[model samples]
Target: MNINDFYTTRKNVFDKLQSSNTATKILMSLLMACFTGVMAQVVIPLPWTPVPITAQTFAVLAAGLILGKRYGALSQILYIVIGILFVPWFGEMTGGLDIVLGSTCGYFLGFIIASYFIGSITEKYAGSRKFKRAIAVIGVANFALIYIPGLAGLALWNYLTYGTMLSISSLLFMGLVPFIFGDIVKILGLGAVSKVFLPKE
Candidate 1:
Protein backbone atom coordinates (compact mmCIF):
# COMPACT_ATOMS: atom_id res chain seq x y z
CA MET A 1 0.00 0.00 0.00
CA ASN A 2 1.00 3.63 -0.53
CA ILE A 3 1.92 5.83 2.43
CA ASN A 4 -1.51 7.42 2.53
CA ASP A 5 -3.17 4.04 2.32
CA PHE A 6 -1.06 2.77 5.18
CA TYR A 7 -2.14 5.65 7.39
CA THR A 8 -5.72 5.13 6.40
CA THR A 9 -5.52 1.47 7.27
CA ARG A 10 -3.98 2.26 10.62
CA LYS A 11 -6.70 4.82 11.36
CA ASN A 12 -9.51 2.46 10.47
CA VAL A 13 -8.14 -0.18 12.79
CA PHE A 14 -7.82 2.30 15.63
CA ASP A 15 -11.31 3.64 15.04
CA LYS A 16 -12.75 0.16 15.28
CA LEU A 17 -10.85 -0.51 18.45
CA GLN A 18 -12.01 2.74 20.00
CA SER A 19 -15.61 2.21 19.01
CA SER A 20 -15.83 -1.36 20.16
CA ASN A 21 -18.20 -2.48 22.95
CA THR A 22 -17.53 -2.04 26.65
CA ALA A 23 -16.26 -5.59 26.97
CA THR A 24 -13.74 -4.97 24.20
CA LYS A 25 -12.61 -1.77 25.83
CA ILE A 26 -12.02 -3.59 29.10
CA LEU A 27 -10.01 -6.22 27.33
CA MET A 28 -8.01 -3.58 25.49
CA SER A 29 -7.27 -1.83 28.77
CA LEU A 30 -6.22 -5.11 30.28
CA LEU A 31 -3.94 -5.69 27.35
CA MET A 32 -2.27 -2.34 27.90
CA ALA A 33 -1.97 -3.16 31.62
CA CYS A 34 -0.23 -6.39 30.79
CA PHE A 35 2.03 -4.50 28.42
CA THR A 36 2.96 -2.15 31.26
CA GLY A 37 3.83 -5.14 33.39
CA VAL A 38 6.03 -6.57 30.68
CA MET A 39 7.75 -3.27 30.09
CA ALA A 40 8.31 -2.94 33.84
CA GLN A 41 10.59 -5.92 33.52
CA VAL A 42 13.09 -3.87 31.52
CA VAL A 43 15.10 -2.99 34.62
CA ILE A 44 18.39 -1.23 35.08
CA PRO A 45 19.43 -1.67 38.65
CA LEU A 46 20.69 1.30 40.65
CA PRO A 47 22.47 0.39 43.85
CA TRP A 48 22.07 3.82 45.43
CA THR A 49 18.28 3.99 45.45
CA PRO A 50 15.17 1.83 45.43
CA VAL A 51 14.05 3.27 42.12
CA PRO A 52 15.78 1.63 39.22
CA ILE A 53 15.60 2.70 35.60
CA THR A 54 12.94 0.97 33.59
CA ALA A 55 10.93 1.35 30.41
CA GLN A 56 7.62 1.32 32.26
CA THR A 57 7.30 5.06 31.81
CA PHE A 58 7.67 4.67 28.08
CA ALA A 59 4.88 2.13 27.97
CA VAL A 60 2.65 4.12 30.31
CA LEU A 61 3.01 7.26 28.22
CA ALA A 62 2.22 5.34 25.08
CA ALA A 63 -0.83 3.86 26.76
CA GLY A 64 -2.27 7.32 27.27
CA LEU A 65 -1.58 8.30 23.68
CA ILE A 66 -3.10 5.17 22.25
CA LEU A 67 -5.95 4.50 24.66
CA GLY A 68 -7.11 8.05 25.40
CA LYS A 69 -8.04 9.30 28.90
CA ARG A 70 -10.48 6.78 30.36
CA TYR A 71 -8.90 3.59 29.10
CA GLY A 72 -5.37 4.86 29.56
CA ALA A 73 -5.95 5.49 33.26
CA LEU A 74 -7.75 2.18 33.53
CA SER A 75 -4.76 0.44 32.04
CA GLN A 76 -2.46 1.95 34.66
CA ILE A 77 -4.93 1.26 37.47
CA LEU A 78 -5.26 -2.35 36.43
CA TYR A 79 -1.51 -2.73 36.29
CA ILE A 80 -1.10 -1.38 39.82
CA VAL A 81 -4.04 -3.32 41.22
CA ILE A 82 -2.86 -6.54 39.72
CA GLY A 83 0.62 -6.02 41.03
CA ILE A 84 -0.72 -5.25 44.51
CA LEU A 85 -3.26 -8.02 44.59
CA PHE A 86 -2.03 -10.87 42.45
CA VAL A 87 1.30 -11.08 40.72
CA PRO A 88 4.89 -9.92 40.67
CA TRP A 89 4.48 -7.68 37.68
CA PHE A 90 6.70 -4.90 38.91
CA GLY A 91 10.31 -4.34 37.99
CA GLU A 92 12.99 -6.63 39.43
CA MET A 93 10.30 -9.31 39.54
CA THR A 94 8.62 -7.95 42.63
CA GLY A 95 4.99 -7.24 43.64
CA GLY A 96 2.15 -7.61 46.24
CA LEU A 97 0.61 -5.38 48.94
CA ASP A 98 3.95 -5.03 50.71
CA ILE A 99 5.31 -3.41 47.60
CA VAL A 100 2.82 -0.60 48.16
CA LEU A 101 4.83 0.43 51.23
CA GLY A 102 8.11 0.49 49.40
CA SER A 103 9.96 3.56 48.13
CA THR A 104 8.67 3.27 44.56
CA CYS A 105 4.99 3.32 45.47
CA GLY A 106 4.82 6.98 44.64
CA TYR A 107 6.00 6.30 41.13
CA PHE A 108 3.19 3.81 40.71
CA LEU A 109 0.71 6.41 41.86
CA GLY A 110 2.28 8.89 39.49
CA PHE A 111 1.89 6.47 36.65
CA ILE A 112 -1.89 6.53 36.97
CA ILE A 113 -2.07 10.30 37.05
CA ALA A 114 0.45 10.65 34.26
CA SER A 115 -1.64 8.43 32.07
CA TYR A 116 -4.54 10.80 32.52
CA PHE A 117 -2.37 13.78 31.70
CA ILE A 118 -1.09 12.21 28.53
CA GLY A 119 -4.49 10.94 27.48
CA SER A 120 -6.21 14.24 28.04
CA ILE A 121 -3.60 16.20 26.15
CA THR A 122 -3.38 13.59 23.45
CA GLU A 123 -7.11 13.71 22.82
CA LYS A 124 -6.96 17.46 22.40
CA TYR A 125 -3.83 17.75 20.29
CA ALA A 126 -3.11 14.54 18.40
CA GLY A 127 -5.72 15.16 15.75
CA SER A 128 -4.20 18.49 14.93
CA ARG A 129 -1.26 16.69 13.27
CA LYS A 130 1.10 19.22 14.69
CA PHE A 131 4.46 17.61 15.34
CA LYS A 132 5.88 20.08 17.83
CA ARG A 133 2.55 20.21 19.60
CA ALA A 134 2.64 16.45 20.12
CA ILE A 135 6.12 16.64 21.58
CA ALA A 136 5.26 19.52 23.88
CA VAL A 137 2.05 17.99 25.18
CA ILE A 138 3.33 14.50 25.88
CA GLY A 139 6.75 15.58 27.05
CA VAL A 140 5.47 18.16 29.52
CA ALA A 141 2.67 16.06 30.95
CA ASN A 142 4.57 12.80 31.26
CA PHE A 143 7.69 14.30 32.79
CA ALA A 144 5.98 16.67 35.21
CA LEU A 145 3.12 14.46 36.28
CA ILE A 146 5.21 11.37 36.90
CA TYR A 147 8.07 13.07 38.70
CA ILE A 148 5.96 15.23 41.02
CA PRO A 149 4.49 12.24 42.77
CA GLY A 150 7.55 10.11 42.25
CA LEU A 151 9.77 12.54 44.14
CA ALA A 152 7.15 12.99 46.80
CA GLY A 153 6.96 9.25 47.34
CA LEU A 154 10.72 8.99 47.47
CA ALA A 155 10.85 11.67 50.12
CA LEU A 156 8.00 10.19 52.09
CA TRP A 157 9.51 6.73 52.03
CA ASN A 158 12.78 8.11 53.28
CA TYR A 159 10.98 9.98 56.03
CA LEU A 160 9.03 6.95 57.13
CA THR A 161 12.12 4.82 57.13
CA TYR A 162 14.60 7.26 58.66
CA GLY A 163 12.26 9.47 60.68
CA THR A 164 13.68 12.50 58.85
CA MET A 165 12.89 13.76 55.39
CA LEU A 166 15.78 14.31 53.13
CA SER A 167 16.24 17.68 51.53
CA ILE A 168 14.58 18.37 48.20
CA SER A 169 17.98 18.13 46.59
CA SER A 170 18.40 14.61 47.86
CA LEU A 171 14.96 13.58 46.64
CA LEU A 172 15.65 15.08 43.25
CA PHE A 173 18.95 13.24 43.06
CA MET A 174 17.47 9.93 44.03
CA GLY A 175 14.21 9.94 42.08
CA LEU A 176 14.53 12.46 39.28
CA VAL A 177 18.15 13.13 38.54
CA PRO A 178 19.21 9.63 37.64
CA PHE A 179 16.38 9.27 35.16
CA ILE A 180 16.69 12.61 33.39
CA PHE A 181 18.79 11.49 30.45
CA GLY A 182 16.79 8.37 29.80
CA ASP A 183 13.49 10.14 30.37
CA ILE A 184 14.29 12.84 27.85
CA VAL A 185 15.31 10.29 25.29
CA LYS A 186 12.05 8.45 25.82
CA ILE A 187 10.00 11.62 25.66
CA LEU A 188 11.59 12.88 22.48
CA GLY A 189 11.39 9.51 20.84
CA LEU A 190 7.77 8.99 21.87
CA GLY A 191 6.73 12.49 20.91
CA ALA A 192 8.32 12.18 17.52
CA VAL A 193 6.53 8.95 16.80
CA SER A 194 3.28 9.75 18.59
CA LYS A 195 1.33 10.58 15.44
CA VAL A 196 1.73 7.05 14.16
CA PHE A 197 0.88 5.80 17.63
CA LEU A 198 -2.18 7.86 18.49
CA PRO A 199 -5.61 6.91 17.17
CA LYS A 200 -6.16 8.99 14.06
CA GLU A 201 -9.29 11.06 13.79
Candidate 2:
Protein backbone atom coordinates (compact mmCIF):
# COMPACT_ATOMS: atom_id res chain seq x y z
CA MET A 1 0.00 0.00 0.00
CA ASN A 2 1.06 3.61 -0.53
CA ILE A 3 2.60 5.33 2.57
CA ASN A 4 -0.18 8.00 2.75
CA ASP A 5 -2.92 5.38 2.39
CA PHE A 6 -1.35 3.28 5.13
CA TYR A 7 -1.17 6.26 7.46
CA THR A 8 -4.81 7.18 6.78
CA THR A 9 -5.96 3.61 7.47
CA ARG A 10 -3.98 3.48 10.73
CA LYS A 11 -5.49 6.77 11.91
CA ASN A 12 -9.00 5.54 11.24
CA VAL A 13 -8.32 2.33 13.14
CA PHE A 14 -6.88 4.21 16.10
CA ASP A 15 -9.90 6.52 16.24
CA LYS A 16 -12.24 3.55 16.25
CA LEU A 17 -10.26 1.90 19.05
CA GLN A 18 -10.41 5.03 21.16
CA SER A 19 -14.13 5.33 20.61
CA SER A 20 -14.61 1.73 21.68
CA ASN A 21 -12.62 2.26 24.87
CA THR A 22 -14.68 5.30 25.78
CA ALA A 23 -17.90 3.42 25.22
CA THR A 24 -16.68 0.55 27.35
CA LYS A 25 -15.87 2.87 30.22
CA ILE A 26 -19.28 4.50 30.06
CA LEU A 27 -20.99 1.11 29.97
CA MET A 28 -18.99 -0.13 32.93
CA SER A 29 -19.92 2.92 34.98
CA LEU A 30 -23.62 2.47 34.33
CA LEU A 31 -23.43 -1.24 35.08
CA MET A 32 -21.64 -0.59 38.34
CA ALA A 33 -24.31 1.85 39.39
CA CYS A 34 -26.96 -0.71 38.63
CA PHE A 35 -25.05 -3.33 40.56
CA THR A 36 -24.97 -1.02 43.57
CA GLY A 37 -28.71 -0.52 43.36
CA VAL A 38 -29.21 -4.25 43.31
CA MET A 39 -26.96 -4.60 46.30
CA ALA A 40 -29.05 -2.07 48.18
CA GLN A 41 -31.89 -4.55 48.09
CA VAL A 42 -29.99 -7.09 50.13
CA VAL A 43 -30.90 -5.31 53.34
CA ILE A 44 -31.29 -6.61 56.87
CA PRO A 45 -32.85 -4.27 59.38
CA LEU A 46 -31.45 -3.71 62.84
CA PRO A 47 -34.02 -3.27 65.57
CA TRP A 48 -32.16 -0.55 67.42
CA THR A 49 -30.92 1.53 64.53
CA PRO A 50 -32.43 3.20 61.47
CA VAL A 51 -29.66 2.00 59.16
CA PRO A 52 -29.77 -1.48 57.81
CA ILE A 53 -27.00 -3.90 56.82
CA THR A 54 -26.74 -4.22 53.08
CA ALA A 55 -24.45 -5.36 50.29
CA GLN A 56 -23.76 -1.74 49.23
CA THR A 57 -20.34 -1.48 50.92
CA PHE A 58 -19.05 -4.46 48.95
CA ALA A 59 -20.36 -3.05 45.69
CA VAL A 60 -19.00 0.42 46.43
CA LEU A 61 -15.50 -0.87 47.11
CA ALA A 62 -15.57 -3.11 44.08
CA ALA A 63 -16.61 -0.22 41.84
CA GLY A 64 -13.74 1.90 43.14
CA LEU A 65 -11.17 -0.83 42.64
CA ILE A 66 -12.30 -1.54 39.10
CA LEU A 67 -13.16 1.90 37.72
CA GLY A 68 -10.61 4.21 39.34
CA LYS A 69 -11.43 7.54 41.04
CA ARG A 70 -13.30 9.58 38.46
CA TYR A 71 -15.51 6.87 37.08
CA GLY A 72 -16.01 5.15 40.43
CA ALA A 73 -17.30 8.35 41.98
CA LEU A 74 -19.42 8.99 38.92
CA SER A 75 -21.02 5.59 39.28
CA GLN A 76 -21.93 6.34 42.87
CA ILE A 77 -23.34 9.73 41.94
CA LEU A 78 -25.48 8.12 39.30
CA TYR A 79 -26.70 5.57 41.82
CA ILE A 80 -27.67 8.28 44.26
CA VAL A 81 -29.48 10.30 41.62
CA ILE A 82 -31.33 7.26 40.42
CA GLY A 83 -32.46 6.41 43.91
CA ILE A 84 -33.60 9.94 44.58
CA LEU A 85 -35.44 10.57 41.32
CA PHE A 86 -36.80 7.30 40.02
CA VAL A 87 -36.43 3.93 41.65
CA PRO A 88 -36.48 2.95 45.28
CA TRP A 89 -32.99 1.50 45.05
CA PHE A 90 -31.74 2.64 48.41
CA GLY A 91 -31.85 0.26 51.35
CA GLU A 92 -35.21 -1.43 52.01
CA MET A 93 -36.22 -0.30 48.51
CA THR A 94 -36.64 3.20 49.82
CA GLY A 95 -35.83 6.41 47.98
CA GLY A 96 -36.86 10.05 47.41
CA LEU A 97 -35.70 13.37 48.84
CA ASP A 98 -37.04 12.41 52.22
CA ILE A 99 -34.61 9.56 52.50
CA VAL A 100 -31.76 11.55 51.05
CA LEU A 101 -32.32 14.27 53.62
CA GLY A 102 -33.13 11.89 56.44
CA SER A 103 -30.96 10.21 59.04
CA THR A 104 -29.00 8.23 56.43
CA CYS A 105 -28.02 11.20 54.27
CA GLY A 106 -24.52 11.29 55.65
CA TYR A 107 -23.90 7.70 54.63
CA PHE A 108 -25.01 8.50 51.10
CA LEU A 109 -22.65 11.45 50.94
CA GLY A 110 -19.90 9.32 52.45
CA PHE A 111 -20.38 6.76 49.71
CA ILE A 112 -19.43 9.30 47.06
CA ILE A 113 -16.38 10.53 48.96
CA ALA A 114 -15.17 7.06 49.90
CA SER A 115 -15.56 5.76 46.36
CA TYR A 116 -13.44 8.58 45.01
CA PHE A 117 -10.68 8.14 47.58
CA ILE A 118 -10.62 4.37 47.29
CA GLY A 119 -10.41 4.51 43.54
CA SER A 120 -7.73 7.18 43.64
CA ILE A 121 -5.57 5.16 46.04
CA THR A 122 -5.98 1.95 44.08
CA GLU A 123 -5.11 3.64 40.83
CA LYS A 124 -1.99 5.21 42.27
CA TYR A 125 -0.33 2.19 43.90
CA ALA A 126 -2.24 -0.88 42.82
CA GLY A 127 -2.11 0.16 39.20
CA SER A 128 1.64 -0.24 39.20
CA ARG A 129 1.44 -3.56 41.03
CA LYS A 130 3.39 -2.01 43.91
CA PHE A 131 2.60 -1.40 47.57
CA LYS A 132 -0.36 -3.72 47.50
CA ARG A 133 -0.78 -3.15 51.21
CA ALA A 134 -1.88 0.39 50.45
CA ILE A 135 -4.99 -0.94 48.84
CA ALA A 136 -6.00 -2.85 51.98
CA VAL A 137 -5.20 0.04 54.26
CA ILE A 138 -7.06 2.55 52.11
CA GLY A 139 -10.03 0.27 51.81
CA VAL A 140 -10.33 0.08 55.59
CA ALA A 141 -9.84 3.80 55.93
CA ASN A 142 -12.67 4.45 53.47
CA PHE A 143 -14.99 2.47 55.72
CA ALA A 144 -14.35 4.99 58.44
CA LEU A 145 -15.21 7.74 55.99
CA ILE A 146 -18.56 6.12 55.43
CA TYR A 147 -19.23 5.58 59.14
CA ILE A 148 -18.27 9.06 60.25
CA PRO A 149 -20.79 10.78 58.07
CA GLY A 150 -23.35 8.09 58.74
CA LEU A 151 -23.17 8.42 62.51
CA ALA A 152 -23.20 12.18 62.36
CA GLY A 153 -26.25 12.22 60.15
CA LEU A 154 -28.03 9.82 62.44
CA ALA A 155 -27.29 11.88 65.50
CA LEU A 156 -28.19 15.17 63.87
CA TRP A 157 -31.44 13.88 62.54
CA ASN A 158 -32.51 12.53 65.90
CA TYR A 159 -31.60 15.67 67.78
CA LEU A 160 -33.32 18.01 65.35
CA THR A 161 -36.54 16.06 65.11
CA TYR A 162 -36.87 14.46 68.51
CA GLY A 163 -34.89 16.81 70.75
CA THR A 164 -32.76 13.83 71.80
CA MET A 165 -28.99 14.00 71.62
CA LEU A 166 -27.25 10.69 71.12
CA SER A 167 -24.00 10.35 73.08
CA ILE A 168 -20.80 9.31 71.32
CA SER A 169 -21.02 5.83 72.77
CA SER A 170 -24.62 5.48 71.72
CA LEU A 171 -23.83 6.64 68.21
CA LEU A 172 -20.97 4.19 67.96
CA PHE A 173 -23.11 1.39 69.26
CA MET A 174 -25.84 2.04 66.74
CA GLY A 175 -23.83 3.02 63.71
CA LEU A 176 -20.43 1.38 63.98
CA VAL A 177 -20.30 -1.54 66.33
CA PRO A 178 -22.68 -3.93 64.64
CA PHE A 179 -21.20 -3.33 61.22
CA ILE A 180 -17.45 -3.45 61.87
CA PHE A 181 -16.96 -7.17 61.30
CA GLY A 182 -19.02 -7.20 58.12
CA ASP A 183 -17.23 -4.15 56.71
CA ILE A 184 -13.84 -5.71 57.46
CA VAL A 185 -14.86 -8.69 55.39
CA LYS A 186 -15.91 -6.39 52.56
CA ILE A 187 -12.59 -4.52 52.61
CA LEU A 188 -10.57 -7.74 52.52
CA GLY A 189 -12.80 -9.04 49.77
CA LEU A 190 -12.15 -5.91 47.74
CA GLY A 191 -8.40 -6.39 48.13
CA ALA A 192 -8.60 -9.98 46.97
CA VAL A 193 -10.82 -9.15 44.03
CA SER A 194 -8.63 -6.21 43.00
CA LYS A 195 -5.75 -8.58 42.40
CA VAL A 196 -7.86 -10.39 39.86
CA PHE A 197 -9.21 -7.39 37.94
CA LEU A 198 -7.04 -4.28 38.46
CA PRO A 199 -4.75 -3.67 35.52
CA LYS A 200 -0.98 -3.66 36.08
CA GLU A 201 1.17 -0.95 34.67
Cα lDDT over the full model 1: 0.82
Find the candidate with the highest lDDT and give its number.
Answer: 1
Residue pairs in candidate 1 whose N, alpha carbon or C atoms collide under 3 angstroms: none
Q: In terms of TM-score, how similar is model 1 to the real structure?
A: 0.93
Residues 52-147, candidate 2: write the lDDT tens digits: 888887887767666777888888898999888998999888889899889888888888888887777766764532236645555555667788
Clashing pairs in 2: none
Native-to-model Cα distance after best TM-score fit, residue 188 in candidate 1, in Å: 2.1
Once fitted onto the true fold, the runs of candidate 1 whose alpha carbons sit more than 4 angstroms away are: 199-201
Q: TM-scores of the models, in the given order? A: 0.93, 0.83
lDDT of 1 by residue, 60-116 (tens): 887887787889999999999999889799997899977877898888888888888
